[model samples]
Target: MTSPTLALDPAWITRTVAVALDEDLGPAPGRDVTTQSTIPADAVGAADLVARQDGVVAGLVVAPEVVGQVAARLGLAVPSVDQRVADGTRVARGDVLAVLTGPVQVLLVAERTLLNLASRASGVATHTRRWADALEGTGALVLDTRKTTPGLRALEKYAVRCGGGTNKRMGLYDVAMVKDNHVVAAGSVAAAIEAVRTRFPDVTIQVEADTLDQALEAVGAGARFLLLDNMPTPLLAEVVAAVRAVDPRVELEATGNLTLDRAREVASTGVDYLSVGGLTHSSPILDLALDLEPLQPV
Candidate 1:
C-alpha cells in the first residue's frame, strides 16, 4: 500500500548528462598518432567494470552506456543501454558486473565519464535508501529536504525516490515551511504562520520550533505540521508527548543533525517524519560500472 503521506517515483526529472558528455567528447580517436607510433593499432583489449566500494548500486542503466556513446563517436562499437546491471543491491570491491570489449583506446577514453555518473548518482541513491530503511518497522517515513544541488533538484530527488525515500516539498511554492528566519522576520511564530496561512492557507504549513513551548505555540497557531529543530532527543520526546496531549492530530517531524546512528532513536519519539539533507549533499556514490561483453562469433 502506498503510504498516505509520502509520494515516490516522480521520474519526469531524468538526468541525461550522458548524451551531453558524448556530444562534447568526440568519437574515440581511431588511431592515436602517439599510440600508433609507439604501440600496434591491432592491440585490442577488454576490461571488466569492477566495484571499488561497498554500496547500493543505482542509475546503472543510464550510467553504463554513456561511455559506450563516447566510444561509438570515437569509431568503436559501443555497447547497448540494455546491458544488464543489478541495482539497489550491495556489492564489495573487485566484483565484476560488466565487461567492455572494444579498442583499448576507446575504453580508456570513455572510462572517466562512465565512472563519474556511476559514483555520483549511486551515492545519492544509497544515502536516500538508508533513511528509508532507518524508519522501517516504525510508522514514520523518511523525507529528503530541499537542500539539493541547484540544477539537479529533479534528478537528485528522483534518485532519492529510487532509494525509497519520500521527497519533501520540491520548492518554496510546493509546501509552506515556516522556518526560524521567517518566524524572526515576522517577529513571532504566530505572525509567520499567519502570513503563510493568509497567503496560502490551503498549503501545508510546517513550523520549526526549538522548545516544547514553541512547538505547542505552533500547534496552537494552527500549523499543520511542526518541525522540532535542534532539540535533544529527550526534549523531542517531551515535546511530542506534550503535543499529543494537547492536539493529537498535529503532525510532528524532526530535523537537524539527524545522522544514521541517531535515526531509530529519534523515530522512536513518534514523530511523523525525519528530514535528512545528506542524501544529496554529502552522500557517497553508488558503486557501479559498465563493461562490454565480447560479441558472439558467427
Candidate 2:
C-alpha cells in the first residue's frame, strides 16, 4: 500500500478538534482520571495509523489537527501533524498516513474521533474517484450536487476534486442552478433565467429542463448551460443534438439517476457535465485504524 496523501484544510483540522474538546471537556478537568490511573504517567506509546479498507484519501490535512487538539486538551503537546500525507491519493490495507506521538491518555482519547474523520473523508475521495474513473475517456467531468454533509461542504467538495471530479455550485451563491421547481415557480425556464440574468448579469445560468422543448426554452433565455434532468439516453442524445443544432455555443449538463455503469454511455453524447448525488448521499466510507506500540520506559 502506498502512503496517504494528506491535503486537509488546516482550519477545519483545528476547528474539528477544538469542538471535540469543547464538547467533551470544555468545563471538565483535564487528564482523564480513568486513563491516568490505568496507564502510568511515565509510560510512552507509539501507534501506526493504518487503514483496514482500500480508498482514496482526503482531508488528511486535518489528522494532525485532531491530534494536536486532543494533546493540548490533555495538557500534552505533541507535534501537530508533523508531516502530511497527500490528498486524493489511493491507500491500501496497512498504510501509514501519519505518525502521532503523545501521552498514552491523549492518544487513546483521540482515537475514535481521529479515525472517524480520516475514514469518512477518504471515503468520499474514494467514492468520487470511482465515478470519475468510470467516465475516464468520455471527456465528461463528473460533478457533485448539493447533497453534502451539513458543515463539511468545503471538505467534501475538496475530496471530490481530489478524486478527479468537478464541483457544481459550491452553494447557492457560487452559481445559480434553476431546477424543476424553480422553473415551474417562475412559470417558465425562460422566466427564471431572465429574472436571474436581470439581477446577476455576470453569473452563469443553468436551468434544468425535463424535456427537449423545455430545454430549448432555457437556451432561448440566454442560459449558458442546460441541465437535462432525468432524460433517457435516447432522449439525451436527441437533446444534445438539438441544443447544438439550435446554438452550438450552449453547454449541456446531465443529471438524475446517473450511475457508474451508465455514465460512460451518457457522456459519449458530448455533454459537458454529469452531476451525481451519490458522491455524498450514498458513497461508502474508507476504513482506517490506529495501532499503538508499547512505550519502553525512557
Candidate 3:
C-alpha cells in the first residue's frame, strides 16, 4: 500500500526509474546478459527485499515502477511487486519489505536499481529521524538544505519529510535565499532583498546572517525568514530574542556545524527551525538486499 504521507509523483517515479534502468541495462535492446545466458526463457522466481539493518523504510512506492520498466526493457511480462511495508514505516533488520514474483530474468534485472533507490532514501530518512527525535518538544522543526543527490532531490527531500523534517526550499526558483555572496553582489542585505523582491515578489525570501547586526538588518529590511548561519548558541539565542522583539513573526533557522549532541541546546534558543545539510550529503545507505529464491521451472 502507498503511504499517504509520501507524495511521490507517478510521472517522476516513471521517469526516474526509466533513467535508472537505462543506466544499469544500457540503451534500448541492451539487456542483462548474465540473466539471459543463465535463466531459462520461461523460468520464474520469487524474492524478498530484506532489510539488513534497522531503519525507516522509504522508496518502496517506487519498486513497482522499477520492476515494470525493467520488464519493458527486457521484453518480458511485468513482474508482480507486492510491497509489504509502507514508506515511513520503521523496519527492523531481516524484515521483508516487499515480495517479487515474476520471470527470473526480470527479477535479476531490476534488483540493483530498486535496492539503490530504497537504500539511499531509507538512509536519509534514518538520519533525519535522529535529528527530528533530538529536537522533539522543543517547538523547533528540522529542515533539509539543497545538499541533495544531483538527480534525486525530490526523492531525498521526500525522505526527509518521512522522517519528520521539513523541506527548506525545493530549488532556487522557489525561494530567494540571500547568502553572503548575494549580499556581496548586491552591496547590502537590504539591496539584495529589494532586488529579489522587485524581480520575484511572490517568492519567499530568506536571508543568511552571520552576525546579530545582520540579522536585525535583514528583519528591518522586511526579510520574514532568516538563516542564522554558524552562530554560537549564546549569540543565536540573543539574535532570536532581538529578532522576536522587533518582529515576532520573522522565522529563524539555525544552521551549520550542528551536532546531535547540541541539537536541544540549539533548539532551546527559540529558533523556529534547524537546517542540516548532512541529512542527504553524509547519510550512509540503509543496508538492504534482494534475496532471490531458487528459480522454478515454468
Candidate 4:
C-alpha cells in the first residue's frame, strides 16, 4: 500500500503538542503523580495504541512528539513510537495504530495526551468522510469552515483534508469574507465587495449573499467566490445558475444547516462546495486507547 502523506507543519505540531502536554501535566517540572507513585523508575514497558472503533486515522505523527515532551517533563527516557498506520488511512476496530516503548511511567504520563489528539482528529476525519462519500460524483467537494476549536484549527483542518474535505480559509487574514454585517456596513453587497477588493487587492474576496440579487451583485462587483447562505435547493440552484451565467469561474458554496442526508441534493445544484461547520465544531471523538504490556529491557 502507498504511504499516506500528511502535510502538517513541524513547528505547529511541536507547539500544539507542548501546550496539550502542559495542560495534562501542568507547568514546568510537572508530574503525573499517579504514575510516579506506582511505576518503578527502572521499569520499562511497551504499549499499542489500539482502535476501539472503525474510523480514519490521523495525528499518529504527533504521538511521538507528545511522548518526547512528556518524558522530558518527567525526566524519563522518551518512548520509541512505531506508527503502524499512516494518517488518512482507514482502519477497522482492533487495529494497532502505533506502538510505544519506554519507561512505564513515561507511557502512562503520555497516554491521555496521545489519545486525546489522535481521537479528536480521527473523529473529524471520520465525520468528513461521510460528507465526501455522499457528495461523490456530484462535482462538488465538502469544505470545512472557520468554526473549529481555537488553537486546534490547524490540526482539525488537517484532519478535514485527511477525510477528503477542503478547507475554506485558514482564518480572517487569508480571505476577506463579507458577511451580512459587512454588507449592512458598506451599504450593499457590491459596495462591500469593492471596499474589500480596494483595501486588499492581493487577497481573494468572498461575499456572502442571502438573495439572488446579492449574489449577482457580488459577481458584478468582481467577487469570483460567493457563499450562498442558508438557501433552499431551488433558490440555491437558481443562484448557482445565475452566477454561472455571469461568470462560470465564479465558484459557489452552499452553506448552513447542511446534513449528510441532503448532501447530494445540495451538491446537485452545481455549487462548487458544501461548507459544513459540523465537521470541526461537532464531530465526536473516535474511540482509541493505549493497551500497555510488560516488556523486558532491551
lDDT of every model, 2 decimals? 0.70, 0.77, 0.90, 0.89
lDDT per residue (tens digit) for residues 1-298 in model 1: 1232333233322235444453445432333345336433344567677777776666555544555555555565663333336655666776765666656655665666667656776688778777788779988888888788775666567667767777788898878888888988999999988888788877778888999889889988887688899888999999999999998998888999888889899999999988888888888766656454453433
Pairwise TM-score winner, candidates 1 and 4: 4
Q: What is the lDDT of candidate 3?
A: 0.90
RMSD of 2: 3.8
- Candidate 2 lDDT by residue in tens digits, 142-169: 8888899887776777788888888788
Tens-place lDDT digits, model 4, residues 120-185 = 999999999989989988999999988999999988999998998888888989889999998889
Enumerate residue pairs that collide in model 2.
Answer: 5-85, 5-86, 5-87, 6-85, 6-86, 8-61
Ranking of predictions according to lDDT: 3, 4, 2, 1
Q: Please tell me which predicted candidate would have the highest lDDT against the true structure.
A: 3
lDDT of 3 by residue, 79-98 (tens): 89888988888999999999
Candidate with the larger TM-score of 1 and 2: 2
TM-score of each: 0.75, 0.90, 0.97, 0.96
- Which stretches of candidate 4 lie above 4 Å from their native place? 1-6, 295-298
Clash count list over all predictions = 11, 6, 0, 0
Off by over 4 Å in 3: 1-6
lDDT of 4 at 18: 87
